[model samples]
Target: MPGEAPYLAVADVLRARILAGEWGVGERLPSRARLAEEYGVGRNVVQRAVDRLIIDGHLEGRAGSGTYVRSPRERLRLVRSRHRERPAGFPLRPGTRERGRADAWDAHSQVRVSAPAEIAGRLDISPGDLCVTTHYEFLAAGQPVQLSASWEPMALTDGTPIVLPEQGPLAGKGVVERMRSIGVVVETVVEVPRPARATHAQANLLGIGAGDLVLLIERTIYDTRGRPVETADMVIPDRHREVVYEFGVDLP
Candidate 1:
């Protein structure tokens, strides 16, 4: 298109050179002013071009440093199941393989939160109902890989030992075990996955640029009677992990 923005044309030229290996991987490109002089365009045009490449994952900008070609990221797989989730150590006891290397997490829980409208709808409860909320940050191989926020209705667990998801006797056990301890069987889990732009908070924690692509998963667990016991939102940085879903064949 002849009417395309000048910066876009500049970006195309830069991208071609980068892909053609003119600028070696991890090598900084010429200064914006130098690039402008070479391309016979203004420095502002060169900067816009560089910014476009950055957003396209072709280049990276370091604060107080120049832009350089982006190196390939080391991506891992995070496989989830519609079936039961046992403890990571359950391999010897019979269960699916665990995901992530040296998986670890930090979490905090608060009591008596008012469920937001969206969360309430997911939980099939009235808006503003009392609930317990927990925030989680998960790390794999010493790097932050995922984040989640979970809410559980206080009505079900107020006086129980498992009221707090990560406290008391069953601490560190997942939602399934904790609820099972309280005699509430989690019969089903539903996950809705979608793409989103990383927010400032997510970017800071995941070590990525703001507005980067991420996978957002909304999950809800239900009892045998179809009553929701908990709902959570999981955020996964796309550059770090790819989600896989596997199911066993039914022999009906």
Candidate 2:
């Protein structure tokens, strides 16, 4: 069943080319019929390959327009981590509170129990330090909309009331709120975002393929004395989320 189809071979070739930079971001791939002739296969076979790439995030299809490669933008600026004010009329009843408790965003589906090497480095904890990971897959109208992960030190959350999903987003919600209640006054929130490809595990969880473009956001919360308290790394599906920040800056 696996790799038996001619189209599968073609898909593999396309994947290699994209990784090899033969088709750089934003470049257009050859038409299906054209690729079919070149690959000595039927047009249907080539169409299948193209469809696979689209699901994998290597290509984008525009209505009435040709499919193009994905071009990710660089980090726009040094962003400060802050709670995004939910837009008025934006759906709130179905927030993380409801979904996570209902077993909709269960650890079995959304969270990873193991910590990889890279994640360990970001957390500044020893490799394999106990980390409780909670992942969320936000869907909009039956379509996969957004993917995110939240991690907290096991020592901090283990057997704590805050471990419960319902306690996550209460009044003055988010990590900041809970920390403040515990006498941890957060003074700074740092955010860093980069363009990244999904890992094999991430791909399986997000229902996307590896090498697909995704946004990697790392947020670090620091205490009043500037000591890091917690870190959260979120892998967002670009197709579903358009990131924007609103803040007031004083001008000289």
Candidate 3:
């Protein structure tokens, strides 16, 4: 294509070869010097192309060894359905069926943390209002597959048994149930999902290369009285999972 970067052009050719099985999985790719010579481009251009492939999950770079074709990855299905089980007293178990059995998750909660402007907006609270923030990492078979950062206004849960999200009697119970425990009834949940690239910090946590594709879901839960009870940002890696949104239709 006209005006395309030289490195990008080189990357296209190399990507084709990889997809065509010119290099088998775990097979070491030709050196950058050799590829540059073969493609009639500078070594820097070849290096950039290889880096692109690495970021795209097609190749892996060893510390001392050269880049090699990566093994195929299995993408799990992550369903976002409106038909979630809402048991009054039972805490929803961690993990989902799509992620495999024995799925587990860990969470770290910080109390009395001030909500940032964006989070406050999502929760319909003041910018500096005290809130409880919890960071969660969901793993399947010991490998991290998803992450979420949740925030709830402290004013609502303060002095209550559910003050700390991951602690107390209602620990591990979802936002809806916990709020119900304190006489707050949750009625609705809204989620907006957007595609994004992984950042260095997010990549480090999910064990993916930075610049890889990911899905960011912004979720806000509202109560029966139209008050925002909780908000969260869920991150799912593109290479590791496929997101499915299911909705039910009502007939008149």
lDDT top scorer = 3
How far out, in Å, is residue 48 in model 2? 12
Q: What value does the lDDT take at residue 147 in candidate 3?
A: 89
Over 4 Å off, model 1? 5-13, 34-46, 83-99
| Model 1 residue 53 lDDT score | 88
Steric clash pairs (candidate 3): none
- In model 3, where do residues sit more than 4 Å from their true spots? 1-3, 86-102
Q: 1-252, model 2: which lDDT tens digit per residue? A: 144788889988888888899987888888888888888888888888887878666777777777788775322221222434656875433222222111133232222255567766766667777776666665544544456676666655566555533345442256777777667788887778898887888777666666667888887777787766667777765544545543455699
Q: Give the C-alpha lDDT of model 2.
A: 0.64
Note the Cα lDDT for every prediction shown: 0.87, 0.64, 0.89
Model 1 Cα displacement at 20 (Å)?
2.6
Kindly give the stretch of ten consecutive residues in candidate 3 with the minimal lDDT sum: 93-102
Q: Tell me the tens digit of each residue's lDDT in model 3 across 1-252.
A: 224688899889988999999999999999999998998888988899898888888999999999999999988778787878655874323454455422789999999999999999998988999999999998888988898999999999999999888899989888888999989999999999999999998999999999999999999999988999999999999998988776667989
Whole-model lDDT, model 1: 0.87
- For model 1, residues 1-252, the per-residue Cα lDDT tens digits are 134698999999999999999998899999999999988888888898998888667899989999999997767777776555557754421333345743799899999999999999999989999999999989987889999999999999999999988899999888889999889998888999999988999889888888888999999999999999999999998887888776757898
For residue 39, what is the lDDT in candidate 2? 81
